[model samples]
Target: MSLWGKTDSFTYIMNQTKNLGLAVNVISDYDRTNANEYIKRKNVLVIIPSLVENSPYTVYECLINNVNFLASNVGGIPELIPQEHHAEVLFIPTPVDLYGKIHYRLKNININQGLLNHKTILKKLGLSQLNEKTTGAFKKIDEANSPLVSVCITHFERHHLLQQALASIKSQTYQNIEVILVDDGSTTEDSHRYLNLIENDFNSRGWKIVRSSNNYLGAARNLAARHASGEYLMFMDDDNVAKPFEVETFVTAALNSGADVLTTPSDLIFGEEFPSPFRKMTHCWLPLGPDLNIASFSNCFGDANALIRKEVFEKVGGFTEDYGLGHEDWEFFAKISLQGYKLQIVPEPLFWYRVANSGMLLSGNKSKNNYRSFRPFMDENVKYNYAMGLIPSYLEKIQELESEVKSLAEHQWWSFCQ
Candidate 1:
């Protein structure tokens, strides 16, 4: 038996399996090459006994390679498996259940059916094989006709992170782009020095560095928007890294949909880890359809890292200058939504959102007063509807009946005493 993985848990598993007098060949360095080679071996069965998972890619890889696999029937794992193959592929996480399922699968394994199941899932996910000859050719838009996108990035003292963010923007597939970096009052010498170096280095690229005095996040974004000279404005935090095709995708989506405001999903990367094409987790936020009712209670809308038409942004009066409050993005989206502007989600993860241990969101969450301050900014009609929506019609009726019963009981008691 072979065990392949790179995390600390994988090491623990390797040691535990050996301690139990089991001969397990453990490959500590886990990568696609090693995994692919192992899967190609004759008469092999992959077992994923995860207690909790979210659409694991291991199952997909096994299916793609026509290899038999037994996975726990846990979060999103069952959804990936075809309905017909459920009894064969999925098993309970317990050792007894796993062993039984493993024995059953080894005895009745059908490689052809597994391949067919893989193809079915691929088709379902819109990833089926494409014919290059019949596929439409790429049409290049005229240079003059292509819209210029201004990527407005707000920065504080994290110059290192800002450099990464700028590098990502510089690597965009769409060439007709200008970057506006807002330096929101950095007190550190290292940050200041790095900003100056970048200002000189990127001056030839038509990128401008706007300086501000401790104006906070919202105001910093507004400052960047003010200096922008493009038809479309894209906002990004300093910690975010845009994908190579992000600008191109947003431009194409904008033109095709004619949406005034556009937002895309992002991959949530923890700590300082760089974004990888193969790394995907279910922990990230997925933008839902536009619903003002849901938006009132939570940010159903996309993140602040969004693409917007310059005219629409100007019309909405830009982001609110609410310093230290993290819900500025939510409030700005709600404001534009209230004004009947079209806010559309692109449904593709176009960038990487770095989630650090301590950031503005953590600080904002610590203060209970933040949401209270934000409530006044919402529309009165929306607030009333949101409050009313919380109580069900049956619950309201029950409350009314209870009130009447209490009043009647008090009157009877007074009458009996008299």
Candidate 2:
């Protein structure tokens, strides 16, 4: 391996190697146009030792060639490798830590499968070929009267990410907005310190921060909702970042459509590189009909992307805390749909969903995703909804059939084992 350029760190690294008696090569004035082919031919892995970056395209070029890469996990560098591929990619925190890691990779590194996945991501992002959806314009609401919007954010920890999220909100084009931040019983000193700083700076402009005693997602969001003072309410996750035009675009859609729930599709962004903002997207959810039809409950549109009217919150009684962590958003959407509230989807990617390497979805945390652990709570909720006439009887029957199918599959496996 060689250092591609001349730098103080490179010089220091070279000097450090004097005791070990190893050869050092500094490739000067290397042409980037031929870098990929050069790297592929040499079967050499690219090492990016930058302390700060924002989703560099050089990493993708390496991916295109199936060449292994080592990057410091700063800025959006951690997002270069998808959450599923974190185990394979080297995400180091310090440059000195790369010494042992680089040697380990020389002996045991297979990146062909990662290359295939990278190709899939490129296709998914439509980066190879531009399309109409990526190029379309965001529709505007023609009214001049902008209503106040309460943006509710519920956070537990990860203060660094939350700071970015708050900055994104502060930079919104729609100025007639209020932010309600709820710190859900953060036990970390770092979180408390960050929240205290935010409280001093952003406590005005109808912004309020509440610190609760430890109540998880649903309750924390409910606390924020209760304190909100806007006609329209937007739920945001602490880890997610909103576009500058996000609030304006969604408000325009909501005002034009007069729908109870206005939502737009979210695009996945690794690190900090967001796609061209406020563009029409091909993957938006369209209603089956003009009204709240029965088919609306089949899929959960996710609460993070939703902008609901404050009245709708009062009618549906916010989210059901009894349902707990996993399916609370799904159940809330289902409940509101059953109550005959209209849902209108804004056909643009207004939100940037940060897919981190470790989270509830990808961390393989049994405490979060275990079906058996959640089955009883889900079953009781279904029965209660059916009893209260909030859900159709057919849904209850469908649940029973689904349970039967699961049991039959388990029994078949047991029989095979016998």
Candidate 3:
């Protein structure tokens, strides 16, 4: 098939070649030498559409000569295809029912359908579109106080959860907000399903999801904020339900209290496990000082319900993404406090925060994501533990952690506080 000007077909083929480093040549009645050269090269990719006239025979001749191929699955062309072409020749779904087909293709966004199951490919396309929309909106914000409010969330194979999370913002009472959902390397069908459902609606509702790979929550949220256009930034959790006044409350707090960061009291309900030590901390939540420098910020806000003015956030360098899962928010408050920024909380609960254990957390995600990222915080934790003589309880683990810190810090893997 021809590259066929600037269109989806052309973009799809070009992106494939660009990403995989495969060469594609849309051929014509070319001479024997050129055809032979293409046939001999194992890397060259050829795309043939069954809808094109008499092209299956031509593509078959090239395939028999050992040319790599991708054929559009259309009509009865498969009946006449050559044997050697079976493996390399991919049958792609043909465009149909232009209006209805596009609509159906869109509905396939959820990845429940067979043809649209190529979610990784679809996500790349989705991310590309996200980049276009986000870049333009971001460019308008010359500084941190851009008119848009950026609410960042991370998601994996939880479209059911994401659809609700995204809808909360899209349906938010505050209309001048932008929602940025970061994928964090989710290749699952559910991820794409959520993407398709949220994509057009998000764009229409003035929310945009930043398309990303598996960078973990800290990195994903940080990455999304870097692309935000609003004067205020709210860090959000995907599984939680926000009240319509969530953003409005945050903004009002920021404006009235003249504080840099504001968060609401979250109402959390635990599952069957009762409550872990970490989960217990979520109870008896209190409002931290409006000026964190004047008092302590031990419980500023869970990553679940924190919002900050963009300038103060930028000033404190956002969340330390390298912290992975745990204590990233703690480090954020510490650094922001050290920078003399105020952190306050709303007295009322404006979000339904679900406190539960995730499979990933139980299946080593907590460890892996936190391992390298938490090393820096562990150093400080160690210093305190050793000073308080709590080292006896953790002698072996401390030694191991100490060695890791020494090796990584010696190599400058982490930027120590200057």
Q: Following a full C-alpha superposition, what root-mean-square deviation does model 2 have from the true structure? A: 23.3
**Where does the lowest 10-residue lDDT sum fall in candidate 2?**
368-377
Residue-level lDDT of model 2, residues 257-338, one tens digit each, is: 7789877777666664434456434443333332223333334354455788999988878875643345456556666655
What TM-score fits each model? 0.58, 0.51, 0.49
Instruction: At residue 385, give the lDDT of candidate 2.
Output: 27
Q: Residue 160, candidate 1: how far off, in angstroms? A: 1.0
The TM-score ranking, best first, is 1, 2, 3
Which candidate leads in lDDT? 1
For model 1, how does the per-residue alpha-carbon lDDT over 330-354 read when each residue is reduced to its tens digit? 7788777777899999888999988
**lDDT tens readout by residue for model 3, 1-418:** 4445655565667666786564665456779787777655654444565565443565546535645445565654554454443333445555443333334433432221122224665687699988897674432222343246888887776666665666566556666677777877779886777687667877776677777878776687788888888888887877776777778767756655677777677766554222222333455445554333222213344443678788877766676665335556655664565555776667877776666676544554333433333233344433322132223324656777999989988778445543
- Model 1 has an lDDT value of 0.79
Query: Each candidate's lDDT (Cα)?
Result: 0.79, 0.69, 0.59
**Which scores greater on lDDT, model 2 or model 3?**
2
What's the residue-level lDDT of 393 in candidate 1? 37
